[model samples]
Target: MPDDVSTAGRPHIDIASVQRLAELADYVVPFAIRAICTLGVADHLVDGPLPIPDLAKRSNAEPQALLRVLRALAGKGIFTETEPGVFGLTPLAQPLRSDHPVSLREAYPLLVGDLQAWARFDYTLRTGRSSFEYVHGMGYWEYMVEHPEESKRFDGSQAAGTRVEVRTVLSAYDSWAGLNSVVDVGGGNGMFLIGLLSRLRHMRGTLFDQPHVVANAHGLLREAGLTDRCTVVGGSFFDDDVPSGADAYLLKRVLWSWADDRAHLLLSRVREAMREDSRLLIHEPVSFPGDSDEVGKAYDLILLTMGGGCARTEEELHALLGGAGFRISRVIPTPMFPLVEAVPAT
Candidate 1:
């Protein structure tokens, strides 16, 4: 017997049909969140509770429709309605604020914004191809390159995510004490490298990514007063021309964006660029034996649907590294992701 049923004298869900019927509409939450985010609901509620009519006026949405959305969200604990007509932000809704220090509003684009591609998720399962391509008529990176406006949003989302993740990773792992020069592979906008370099003031760094990505990094590096300590390089890792002479190469939240073969190829290229004593640090989510699949599984689905990648288990990653002419040194766990350290095998 299941734990819930065993604890109870009788089964609350004796009929599977009734249970499935009650849970069928669970997919509505993401779209509901996207709808509220699109309307900038959390930002408008900064001061205090507002009546439905007033909130609707600010959002320029239909009063009745906005009221319905407010009511629905309140049930989901995203908002709370006082008395009859006034609605205010719930504790759960605080992270949605655009100005919040640890705001998740930036993540709304990739999470809730890409549901149109996810709507065709079954197509990916059927053909082993990207559903994002099926919907957008191009691969993820190609689409981003062609559309600068959308690409900007996507870049902002990544940098925001890197902020939270870098904090988590730094707290768990030791500082790069012995490593002199570090290169952040596929480093987008130099945000993560900037955070790490700021802490390790003595260490110099390099941010490597595409030309368009590196073009924006110089200004941010200058703004952060890090241009003197960090160099920005523009190129693809696949070409095997990683910026030379760095003792450490870091791939933070990057490897999950490629298929196994491409991941191996990229890692091999990095390996080719490394000296015998150098290290490669891969920071991303991963699975381990007998562990709960909650985080890894959700991320794998997103990769499969949009990014043409997958999160691997420790054993799987071990093989990937070994195949790429490297060996795993250790795996360090963090709140958001793990740090898989590898050294050259040959």
Candidate 2:
């Protein structure tokens, strides 16, 4: 509704129409990124700009198709065509490379490869249930169990994120300080634990996750020389009692994987094992009021489509945690996410 846009309007203004087109065609951008990653185009350009033939040969892709896609990607500023038919990685494309410390190499596949789950995104909208299960005839966790390579890729993607998230959480909260033990509920591959115990040598850590996922952690821990106090125990949070007598329980990015009922059930499991003195910390990427960042919004959609989970508001989380017999002492917000601290309810 700009001054230039009119009700005497024969049609929407050109700018608005083009913006709508941009939004509708948003899938092309990520798909282009995925294409580049899949083709290993960025790796070829790592040294310097190359002619289309060289790039296509290096990536083992069709020359014309690679040129067309690279040209389209360059239009979005992901790459540069300094000279016609030659291209190189731009700063944005650099992170997509395989060796970047926080690489998105494996993450791009999730966006472009999971067609069955995404095809049922509308089911999530209609039923408020998991679209992944709706389409695949199995829950997201179950599907992961059936596809171990996919599970490993997902774990690696999330582990890439822990490098940054761990720093933010550690700096934001001190409750882990001087604590003898912490149980990482749903911790993946001991990435967080390695970072945690590295900083806090006095702390012993237990990583509890699915059997298949935790099965791989022993080697990771051994590689990191964390086998002494760091341990990996495998069990489902929904079906098993959480290990008791820990000074604290840590659920990093766990709650948003399920709906309220399942999330509450998982929390209550931890609550059942809590000593009057045991502390619980949950890593929540809260969607704040009036926030409109696209990445966070898209992440919320991913949880919805994948497992009917969501990034909850503080009020929503408070109500859910209350139902699980814990009280939120405070929310320590960092730029990355909020670390919510809870003590067993009186």
Candidate 3:
């Protein structure tokens, strides 16, 4: 028998709806954590468990306000409340510690600080324009050229992230065994060249980037003691030809920085310079369709916002390489990025 109670007597709650709301609410936590990490709150706690007042003092944040932020983070297992007002770092917060091997402090702030520009992301969705160009008055590269300090932060933060990935890439590739020279297209500060040359004693390398970028490469080369073996070339990839006659040409995190047209142009330039047997190695986070990975999705938005760049699928890469007069030889996966090796199709 049906109950006499009206339908309105039943509870109006929906579990799925409640869960979705909870997830939406949780999104702000990561930004808060980014803010705290950027403020070096975790570094201050490194010495010992500290009260909220002292922690706020060290981080230069207001005590009451900072406590509220930390309290929210504490609920997420990032930090723990030792007692009434004392807080201590947790295992999950270890990466935020400035001195950690793979510390994300710099990377976190760089991303979060750029959040303001993203408020205009709807402009990209509506007009197919870059959020950066919509919010700022210029493209990312132009802005970087004008703002030296911000450029330094952007370069340093990117290089720091690249350091972890580069080691994995270096291990995945067989040493440039028979190659005399390798050209790293768009190599900023020669981080990749340093890693490769460190392993291959017989190899000489060229680090090609903008004038200012290359200006700093010599210092890195000297620090790595590869100044005698490496050359730093300052020129635009679009206007100038990459140094020709190298056995292997490398583009790490470069192609994804442009749209299809620009990528095609860059690859075509590389093809024109390549000998019949020259190899091209492209290292990037290759996206696969229908597979929505977190890093790929986040990077997709980043590329959209930063410079109208994007993460490409394997099929897209194949078509781009094919159009550029190159044949896909192999796609090797590393711990970080996938290396797509190609040779002149002719």
lDDT of each: 0.83, 0.82, 0.82
Q: Write the per-residue lDDT of candidate 3 for residues 232-294, one digit (tens) a residue.
A: 899888989888888999998899988899999999988887889889999887887675553
Query: Per-residue alpha-carbon lDDT of model 1 for 1-346, expressed as tens digits?
Result: 7644646576656577676776664766666776777678889999999999999999888999888888888987998998698999989998788887667777766443366788888898999888898898888878777878778777767766877876777788784788788999999788889998887887899999989868989999999999899998899999749987688999987787777899999998898778899999999878666656456667777788886677888999999899999999988887777888999885
Q: Order the candidates by TM-score, highest first.
A: 1, 2, 3
Worst 10 residues of 1 by lDDT: 106-115
Quote the positional error of residue 149 for candidate 2 in Å.
5.5
Question: For all candidates, what are the clash counts?
Answer: 0, 0, 0
Given candidate 2, what's the lDDT at residue 272? 88
Instruction: Report the C-alpha lDDT of model 2 over 236-300, residue by residue, as the tens digit.
Output: 99998788889999998889877799999999999987789999998867777775553446678
Task: Judge candidate 1 at residue 251 and give its lDDT.
Answer: 93
For each candidate, give its TM-score against the true structure.
0.84, 0.83, 0.82
Clashing pairs in 2: none
Look at candidate 3 and tell me the lDDT of residue 231. 87
